[model samples]
Target: MESSDLRNAGLKVTLPRIKILEMLENSDARHLSAEDIYRRLIEMNEDVGLATVYRVLTQFEAAGLVRRHNFEGGHAVFELERGPHHDHMVCLDSGKVIEFVSEEIEEIQQRIAAKHGYDVEEHSLVLYVRPKNRVAGKVGKG
Candidate 1:
């Protein structure tokens, strides 16, 4: 998102907002915590505060510019709201978040919802998983 996108979202186009939005738009990691953003900003010598990071993230969530996921036993993470429908697999050991889409699962969910006489308006699926062949005392991220 750019300055114009922020203005379109009814948010003022400020330096902090622009920097944060650029981080979200360009980061390789799809999901990130406020602290993560704050650390990166600090690394880049930006003077944005942690509180400001939190506030901006909250505003972004409220404005539908991002989505927050509160995975079990972890701090909330935010992702840009610009992707296709997909489910998440959170690695239990490494806290990695993997996104996937399966037509088979979607069809089965539709069939089950239809059998129950309810249309599937929306749904979210998160599967907490660990590596099947995990090496002892090792962790991996995806």
Candidate 2:
């Protein structure tokens, strides 16, 4: 079924491509760079190379099966574009990422775009932040 989806999207149905697509679709870590995907493949004992991961991800992005995000980091991260739209919040301290959606924020963006005499084609909002209040023994960002 996944291979058919890939074929429909103009991609060759291959083992590495199918495995990478599965990882992107099913991972708890929705946003991942090519390096991250490569690490995951290695962890799974798959022989897919890092260069293959990068190439497959780029192909997926071009085919609109995935979306690439360039957060504050120099590297780019890719996410499967198969769900509702949402923005991201990144914790600077721990490199944690959170996804959120706000109707009010969306309205504000639309209004701003209208005011500027341009239809909003797309928008990406990433808020880089840290904890407001620190709790003892709390070292993780949520």
Candidate 3:
């Protein structure tokens, strides 16, 4: 992903966009909300406004460079488009996200769509889970 790609998509390559993209690129988390991104940016001393982060994220979503997810209540989160399609499992207690690929689930989805005579364009699946008492370092699969 390059900044010029945004320009090609008719979006101006602004500092906030660049910084947000960079942070997203370097992030290990699979899901990040606008507030989370803003906090990270502030920690880096970028000082970009939260609204700016949200606007840039919306632009990125419109450009198809990022995907927005609503796994945790009304707050929206984003993830970069990378590899094959997958779903998410969010830990309710820790707010950790886990990515998992399930062929069985995929087949079931396809069958359901076919049964309804509808070609699936796009879809998102998010499972909310609670971890057993383990106090693990991180609570998610890649």
Best by lDDT: 1
State the local distance difference test value for candidate 2. 0.90
Measured with C-alpha atoms, the lDDT of residue 97 in candidate 2 is 82
Give per-residue CA lDDT, model 1, range 24-130, as digits (tens).
98899999999999999999999999999999999998888999999899999999998588999999999999999999999999999999999999999999999
lDDT of each residue in 5-109, candidate 2, tens digit only: 899999889999999999998788988989999999999999999999999999999998999998886489999987689999998778778999999999999
lDDT of each: 0.93, 0.90, 0.87
What TM-score does prediction 3 earn? Answer: 0.84
RMSD of each: 4.9, 4.9, 6.5
Pairs of colliding residues, candidate 1: none
Better of 1 and 3 by TM-score: 1
Off by over 4 Å in 3: 132-142
Least well predicted 10-residue stretch by lDDT in candidate 1: 133-142
| Model 3 C-alpha lDDT per residue in residues 1-142, reported as the tens digit of each score | 7888878878998889989998889888867889989999999999799999989999899988899887756478899978699998988877888899999999999999999999888788989988787676767878
Compute each candidate's TM-score over C-alphas.
0.90, 0.89, 0.84
